[model samples]
Target: MKSNNTLTFSRRNFIRTSALASGGMLIGFNFFTACKDKVAPPVDISQLNFNNFNAFIKIADNGIVTIFSPNPEIGQGVKTSMPMIIAEELDVAWKDVHVAQGILDTKNYQRQVAGGSQSIRFGWDALRQTGATAKQMLVNAAAAKWGVDASSCSASEGVITNANGDKLGYGDVVKEAAAMEVPENVKLKDPKDYKIIGQDIRNVDIDKIITGKPLFGLDYTAEGMQYASVLRPPAFGQKLVDFDDTAAKAVTGVSEVVRFGDKIAVIASNTWAAMKGKKALKVNWQVDSKLENTADHDKILMDLLDGNSFDTRREDGNVKKAFAEADQVIERTYESPFLPHNCMEPMNFYADVTADKVHLVGPIQTPAGTARRVAEMLERNVDDIHLEMTRMGGGFGRRLYGDFVMEAAEVSNLIKKPVKVVFSREDDMAAGIYRPAIKYRIKASIKDGKVTGYHLKEAAINSNMYGLIPNFFPAGAIANYKVDTANYNSNITTGAWRAPYTNFLAFAEQSFFDELAEALEMDPVQLRLDLLQNVKGTTDERIQYSGERMENTIKLAAKKANWGKKQDGVYQGFSAYYSHNTHVAEVAEVVIKDGFPVVKKVVVAVDCGIVVNPLGAKNQIEGGVIDGIGHAMYSDFGFNEGAPEHTNFNSYQLIRMNQTPIVETYFVENELSPTGLGEPALPPAGGAVANAIKAATGQRLYKQPFIKYIGMEEQELIG
Candidate 1:
């Protein structure tokens, strides 16, 4: 990929229009790029190391610029995007710079966890301001040396140039810049001056990633590092009744086959040896004879349709009155099965444990949480456990759980040596912590060809990935709404995957809207727009959403897609969801082939505030669309007689290159502060694809894994 300077200069015009700023001096100044004082004043930047030259910046005589961002890059591409925000404002050639992943430093970097689509927006102002402040200090140093007014000097491309264009390199002025007092206030660069942020830059680490350099935890290997493999019961809470490790102990390269509590592990010289030894070790599981099958989870969820739930998240008026007055009512039940994260790289962590301290390295999403947990488990201070985050093969939010890390710590402690615990596909899938199998009861009232009311009730195993957002509970996405939920304690362990509840939300809400639109005889997009025109909140009441913004995104996406204009045999479906402080709308075009929804194209429009890295933003939207489509259309988890039904990729399907659709991502020009990008885009795609399938077959399929709703092998044979 030719990542040259041409794209950098073109982005200046992007900021020129996006920032809507004026004046050449403001444009030339690095501090003026982000323009934060519109509805709110600039956040106080004093008395913090966030923008400190030594903390975020390290200048080299060779002109290599490093901007440290304290966030993990879980395939959303913020690793490259956030740094671009600073480099663009600094007016430096992007190629001359590199972005260093900021470690577990809370004071220097705010909220380092990169789950929501927030990486770029989170760093937008702070980093730009940091760069601008550094530039101001440098210019001041030059002005003092040249005996000219500070205002007489301007900054351009890592250099402070005087009015006559007399230039001084940033490296020459850095020592002086470091000594100056931090600026109380500095004018940010007008967007017209941006040389990096808006441009489509290639990924910063793609070269290392593609060249097979060690970028992910699975690829990490250290000298004196022993390997380990875990053997947990196939069922969620099943325990070991008995085990014989005679074969495992005799296997080549195997050191010890030991049981840590009920779970067993094989420690060896290599991952293969550990895996082979684990398979060789025989174990008997004490099955829960009375355990409820997943089908029972389905029944309990369906039983909640009678309206027994929390009624926790609500903000709208009487939905009963709205539905009562409506000309027609459309009701549907949506169901999604428990899904394994199946992150391309199975769960793995490398840890070196000694009596005094432990060092951990791997693809972990929540470094702070992991650090906290690891410290507690090790009975050491938090500072004693150093967490180094690796670029994840993929994190649909599965890595958020630190089980693999804990396993590594356990193995190291048991053997008193540094050990790496790597999960094979079988180990990863069989381990619980799946997206909970859940169900939703959605009812909508339509009058005069528009949606008038919505009553949504969802039930699932509580305490799943991302238990609940502070304000927007499950029922927060629509108005004239009555939202309720109930948690049925299951033996299964669950955690966040991609968009979390978004998986079911897309299916339930979007599918209901589709049915309602059909009953009202209105276009799905038009009906959604009309409803949102008056639809106040994501959760109703205090958890309201900006209807204007939602309407704008739908409209922009429709216009870009040329809705109802093109001749597409493939059906197109649309859905929008607001979570993690961002509004994302997606349109998925799907082809129903023998009950399978083949997603062909994805059109996405997002508003997460200022666009940081256009390339990263696009990559995230694309990846999310593909990831969600996979789960919605094919992914499933089953249980047979209290045992997990699937072990690896063979049983659990995923959306791959042959199945990935052509994704067209368009970022709505906004400067809203950052929100999560990692999982937000995915949740909405579920509904979009389901809606497209509805368009294709004049049928409302409420159950998930689109494969199930259409006709499973058992169902078709029975029918």
Candidate 2:
């Protein structure tokens, strides 16, 4: 099942101690405690296998170092950055290190997911320890060879040196190092000694990417792989009744037509043929009357807004008392529509299923999850399923779900042939696990000039909007605070998209806070700072993020943006939020031109602790900001009669080159452990732009895709 010409790295080449005895070092570092199944037999760890280690670092006798980048790369630059941490600690040059994408081996690389912006957050300490352990082993080996004390020998730049000026390369003593036992506790390098981490290292695959090399999911192929296109139900709640393949089978290059319950697949020799065959498929679907359209779903959400069924996620002092005693109470409702991921590369997976084994290769955010799903679907053992990950063009939390991976596996399992199921832009758009639309109602109590109370009630489809993060910004800062959530069951499928709840919640909360500040005639930036300052010294158990870190990012952002400064034809808006253990604050500068909001510039300040790669970090911030702006200003997934109305870019509008704005990014100087870099910066961008639009025109957009609310003639704002 292996492709010789492919860039896929397999775990089959894992070096054992016997292989290492031939003058090479193979170090296995166990970072995670593996979950054991009671039904499965015990496994001996005496043998050096990839499954026994969380990650494997190999140094050949020729002095080539290879460190496995365990997680899938979805253009977050993890492949370049994660290995950089290891290379820094290994005392090797970055150029000497070969960063290989690790295969799915949960016994070793457990919890290998690319979402939540958590790769660096969780891998920071464990990966460093891995490298440090290897370095200590090498240092010990070099000392034993030189007949010197290990403490007297120091390692640098892949070489060991003693006080007598005797030197030996790491490769010379690697065989000896491989024979030594792994160190239990090895001291990691200080931040001051980080030569590779803070430096601006280009992405590892930059050259291949720029030169049009094949590395993405769409580029993956195996021997005799046939392209496939599936024809799913036309609507969310519909099911396929029957399919006529008479016309589809007649198409050129068409091979076979397969049906599996509600889905029908058209297999062909090539992608175009498969697409043509799919279009020719006459499939009849039975539609469900319930959950027919977006409007109907909106009504359901609105009804649940006041429904009696509610869960009190977080509550403090009496909210009723604060509101009753307040001089005035301000209430507002915000609405956000469902959104499609629209990754640069559409969904696709290649599966070659035989009686004994199921082999899959594609772009997936969670390979381990996909493997488990395939194993369950095939009723096979988990060890028999081999899943390989390719470089994804974009993830944005869309790949977190393994439905597409399962589809390919099931199709291959049934057909008994190698199949590559490719999703057209329309198919990817229509058949979606979209970001759930939400309705949020916020009420604030104002007594004199200080805010006394804050309450938020969110109504979403299938699940609550604020599940894990009930205590958001101003949660601990407000005396009387409460959060209520309700869900409206529907047929629409929903999954995590980027920052998940915070993607849209940050917009609702931060924009409402702006209105609260305006009502009190207080500066928005100053108001957030004041609120954060209140919780800075408190020992409140409700605070999830460090109050000092949050406050620092806010102050630093304002200082960088020149908060009080004014420019001609430009209005500024401020927003701050914390998510994925990262705090971000942003200020947007916009100008109204021809009745539309034109973003001129954006200033972003993040406190994600120590940034691993400055260049990649800035790129992530800029990309996330632009993406947030695009979604806030343009993106919306619409449905009519239970069918997705916008299926392609012709109907769906995305951010264009001309629409991109200048984004200035700054990272607060800190020595704390690094947080995520991909998603935190995105949430605030939406609110910042919305607030900017409000400042430009005396209009508050309560609904998302803000273009729907603005009018040219009268500027009538609508919710």
Candidate 3:
């Protein structure tokens, strides 16, 4: 799985061939090209149609190449970037390439999920081979026509040419190529020769998106389809006791009221009517578990951190001995509350279930997994379920759950009709799969002006950070490093939100570094550089971050922001982090305005390998930084007896446009395969802003939603 050959089309057995009735060439290949356990389907050259193509590539007679992007696109630009990888190797003109979103085809695709920002990274080699293999077949066909050696014939911009200057369009010889044997090995383009990649390609759906066309799940409609609005328990620990739907049935356009498990669904001809009818229904609920509150969670997390019973994630040396011998031990505890994803389009899914087949179409991050779940719930064959993906307004890890998809499928199965389930803003917020509330206590022992010991303890709700995270950054630098984690199982649901644990962890650790620098009487940027230098040549596999890349990123951000040189009224703070296979550094500029800190600008430096599309990459970076800053400064969510305090935007405070600072981005140039860009840039922004606020107001923020401690004294806020 690491090499290009293993990803796709290294041997003839991995290729699938078919003929086009229009005399064009079609190439299909499995993503798991080197998997020995699975067998590829036999080639069928007699199938004379384009519909039989396995959602990979379709070459038309007009020399236009259609590449299917086989990954869910949640506004991360994979729908455009994934196909760009194929077209780059296909040697087709960017103008002649038509990008399309592929359906969930587990037969030919792998890792179709959209979370983790890994679509481009994982699909890079496979997609390149897919296009290269087809190009080789075309070249072979063209060489046969001229009776010349196939090696002398090369393809570029959808044309095949020989050494004698004989030119033929790919379409002109596609018919002959359809009959040719699949090529076992094909030459890929060198990164220096790339024509379509590393270019600013606009989003493929930009036109439709700007014109407000039907490109999102909410815009989907079907014949005789009913819209549904569901009502679940208002509180996390509540369960359904009884319900009365008479008022709902009397509402206009109300068709049916069906109760399933602990929820009730109101079906109607339109979304508004369904929502209105659902509001009219009366239901009773009983507490099924302890109604935990924010105060209770805070106490529990503190107790867990103070207790000795914990899982040791990573321990490098004797932390206890290092701490005992230290001259100074600086300790700080950071806390963050649960947060909602609050996707722009809310949650909605369309499902049409029948005895014969089940049709589903919606914006889902995990379409293949959702389909299997639906199939299991309906007790139908997985092959009988057909699901389609639409462009999502925004996911940020919310759509990965697919709970709304299950609701739609279940409702359709019960009503025996096509149904689309939609969640109100309140429902989306109150009944969300939230980011787990977490607290981290980081202690650094400084001896002889050098860090000798580091210990981090994490207490979380529901789940802890992934095991691999404990190995990232400073884990190899500190000689006596130790990481411990413990979790409290809560009835309230929690799951991945954007960058997950790193979103808040970065702020905690990076802020601690700034404090450590202050205690050592050293510059913060120089302190990070020195730490990275400690692990520069180490060969320890446990360390996940690249010290060289992280050091370069930190230098770039510091140089751009003029790290130590200060302006009269401006204060700056620096933070650097590595996450999701990307290295990022940020510097936040803050100024005091009427006794309040105002963020004026942020300068970001990233090393995510090669840039696929600069425009799209910049968008991701800027969006992440703004989102991180917004949440860290303004957004706050708390639970009162298992009920969310803020259920809508009115109560939930988000950073306003006027408050958003200007962001400048710079990327390191390299030939390495592209890594994720969507979430890596976010984790460092919070840390940068927190450190900046400290410089501006002499206040150290240990809790999220920095606004809570805005006017309070440092001692009062810390206490």
User: Which numbered prediction scores highest in TM-score against the true structure?
Assistant: 3
- Candidate 3, residues 72-151, lDDT tens digits: the string is 88999998988888888889999999887777633333457889977778767777887888888888988999999999
TM-score of each: 0.87, 0.94, 0.95
- Write candidate 1's Cα lDDT for 4-120 as tens digits: 221221222112101111210111112213222111111222322222211245555454676654578888787787777777767677877867765553222224575655556
Against the reference, the lDDT scores of all candidates come to 0.69, 0.83, 0.86
Per-prediction count of colliding residue pairs?
27, 0, 0
Model 3 earns a TM-score of 0.95
Global local distance difference test of model 1: 0.69
lDDT for residue 91 in candidate 1, whole number 0-100: 66
Model 1, poorest ten-residue lDDT window? 17-26
For candidate 2, the 10 contiguous residues with the lowest summed lDDT are 1-10
lDDT of 2: 0.83
Q: Residue 630 error for model 1, in Å?
A: 1.8
Runs of candidate 1 exceeding 4 Å displacement: 1-55, 105-110, 287-290, 307-309, 324-326, 447-450, 463-479, 535-541, 566-570, 591-597, 671-675, 711-719
TM-score pick, better of 1 and 3: 3
For residues 10-61, what per-residue lDDT tens digits would candidate 2 score against the true structure? 2222212312544577665543333222211112223443444556677888
Query: Of the candidates numbered 1 and 2, which has the greater lDDT value?
Result: 2
Clashing pairs in model 2? none
Give the best candidate by lDDT.
Answer: 3
